[model samples]
Target: MIDMTTGNPGKLITRFALPLLLGNILQQTYNIVDSIVVGNFIGSEALAAVGNSGIIIFLLISMFAGIGMGAVILVSQFFGAKQEEKLRTAVDTIYIGMSVAALIITLCGIGAAEPFLRLMHTPEGATMEMSVTYVRTIFLGTAMSFGYNINASILQGIGDSKSPLLFLSIATVLNIVLDLLFVTVFDMGVFGVALATIIAQGTSFIFGAVYINRKIKIFRLFSHRMRFDSRILLQSFQIGLPAGIQNLLFCVGTIVLQRLVNSYGPAFMAGYSATNKIDMFVFMPILSFANAITTYVGQNVGAKNLDRVKEGVRSALIISVSTAIIMSILVTIFGRYLLMAFTQDAEVIKTGEEFIKRLMPGYFLLAIIFTLNSTVRGAGETFMPMLASFVSLLVARVPLAYLFNYIGGRYNIFWCYGAGWFAGSLIIVSYYLSGRWKNKAFRFVEEAEKPKR
Candidate 1:
């Protein structure tokens, strides 16, 4: 674990972000592998099915995912404050809360799989069936998915990003092997891919739990009763609920957008799916910097090194924006080749290239928005970030997508992303300039000095 409370802001943020970038790349590979295998072996229709299900799966888990992020903020602050007992309690509270949430989401997701797909207007017959099968299989292992994420969040909270990367590397390799085995050898199709994902997730979770129990002296997973501390749980929800709502709004908007994409037919859907995987690579580095800064700010804020927090934000923006620009150029130049990795369909490749070209310019705006929002959230001011997302996704992007679709047809839909990012960046920049988030940071410092309950 590296300490960001005392270091050169630029070097610390870069070192911290590298492993996170790699880990996110590996995590995204799980879906990319599934798409590539299904698109090649099973066909485009199957690929489209997996892609459609991916959005729904994200929608299903997004709320808890946001809450898990909230837990990360709390843990980082506690760890930085050297509030060892509070940090342990926060960790335990997170696991207990997430376990219950996983069970509930699993039951609801399995039952709602077909209905949600229908609502999205997924192509009838084979595509619909495959989507439903894949969604249900994935939901069945929601606990494992939640477990792995919880472990990762706890470790990241403590400034240990590399361990999660190691665990994810294991899972990614295992997932690829299983994807080939189940899809090619057993002919399990989409079910095989989903099963591979959850099994790999379960393995990583178990491995992470055992590793933390033995190696991490500050905490233990199985050594004590996992119970919620009311104070920490309430504070977590206070910080997390807005993030959860923000994610829910974003998912709702995407679901609406997916419905629109579905109307364009399965081939277009397949193209869009492939491009989404490529998009993840473009955003990975920016997101890694955003996450790195969040922890950096949280630690510095806890240590009452507010000047370091300011320095870190500037360093993160420079690094992240430069990286974003580089990624845009690279993706624009070679996006067609990347699209071809998923399928050989000329139409899918053409459609994906068009999407990439239209969307690449907006990534700069997105890097700024994400980094700024992450900075505020690290200071324990989550509501403003949530509000910015609301304006960007619901108020700007979704409405503009439909308006553009009506005005210029399906190809115009991609332009809405830039508009949304612009809208979000405005909110984040204004909030950052207003300097209100520092007040939130000070509040956390005061809380840190209170006697442990």
Candidate 2:
């Protein structure tokens, strides 16, 4: 594992962020391939079905993964303090907590697939049917997906970003091949794409587990008790529950935005899905750097290196904003070509282009918000960012979306994107500049009296 506590802040952060950026880009690429294959092979209706299910899936996945992220903060802090025993306990507790949560969420998701689709206002017939099928298939594999994500979070917490990247690269290739085989060769339709994803996720989880077992003695899964520790469990929920709720808030706002989009029909749905995929790619680098800042700040905060932590945040901002500007230019220039890879339909292409033109330029604001939140999050100040997200999503974005739709109809929908970014960025920046996170950084338990596991 790379120790981020020392070394040049820019160089260390850049080195750490590159692998994460590549992995996220590959992940987004494979996701786009799912849409492309479904659109070309199964038809736009199938594409719409998958697209409509995206926010619901995000909401579930993010909620489960958020708790794991909290545990990760603990792991980073403990690891940075060189508290081996506490780090082990944190890992074990996270594994136990996340596994149970994943199982419960899977059951709930499978049982409520139809209701969720209906809630999203998915049209009846094939669109609704395929959506239900796709959601159920994906939900069935939540254990594997959550396992991979939680494990990855633990690795990231300790500054081992490369291994997850390697695992994700393997999984991305597997997912792409399976997507083509299932959809094109076997004609599995929407079910095929979902199955491909699950199998790939399971494979990645297995690989990550093996790596952790071999490389890190503390993460030995079978040797440790799967039972939760009361203190650790409570701490995990304290940090993670709010983060999960933050994710839910963002996704709920997304689902709300999607419902507005769905009212325009399948053509718009397909187009919006395509653009959203590209949007993820465009900001992947910024988000990756933001995450790197979290780990970087996390370890330094644990080590009580306040100066280094502050330096990391400043360096990350420069890197994130510059990268965002470059991406915006690239997307503006080559976006049409990217959209063409997804579909040949003229209407779909036009709608996607419009969405890109409307939203891509505002990514500079997104970079600022993401970087600042990640820094604060690493300092273990999760609640402030969570509240900021609620304000941005509930207080600012949702109402603006409805108002825009009322005033200008379909064309005005893009207005919500800019308003949300600006509001979230402003709120987070204000909090970060207030310097409260510095006080929240040091909460380390003394290593002398370690709890028995």
Candidate 2 has which clashing residue pairs, if any? none
lDDT against the true structure, each candidate: 0.90, 0.86
- For model 1, give the 10-residue run with minimal summed lDDT: 442-451
lDDT per residue for candidate 2 within 1-453, as digits (tens), equals 879999999989999999899989889988999999999999989989998997888887787677777788888888788887778878888887777888888988899889978988898999999999999999999988887887788889899899899889888999999999999999999999999999999999999898898988665764646545668767667667888889999988888888888888899998998888888998899989998999998888778898998888899999999989899889988989999998998988888988888787788988998899889988878888898788878888889889988997776787777788888888899999889888777764443245556
Candidate 1 Cα outliers beyond 4 Å, as residue runs: 448-453
Alpha-carbon lDDT of model 2: 0.86
Per-model TM values vs. the true structure? 0.98, 0.97
Give the number of colliding residue pairs in candidate 2. 0
What does the lDDT read for residue 45 in candidate 1? 95
What is residue 291's positional error in candidate 2, in angstroms?
0.9
lDDT of 1 by residue, 1-453 (tens): 878999799999999999999999999998799999999999999999999988788888888888888888988988888888878888888888888899999998999999999999999999999999999999999999988988888888889999999999989999999999999999999999999999999999999999999889987785567667777777778778888888888889899999999999999999999999999999999999999999998888777788999999999999999999999999999999999999999989988998898899889999999999999999999999999999999999999999999998888899999999999999989999999888778565466467767
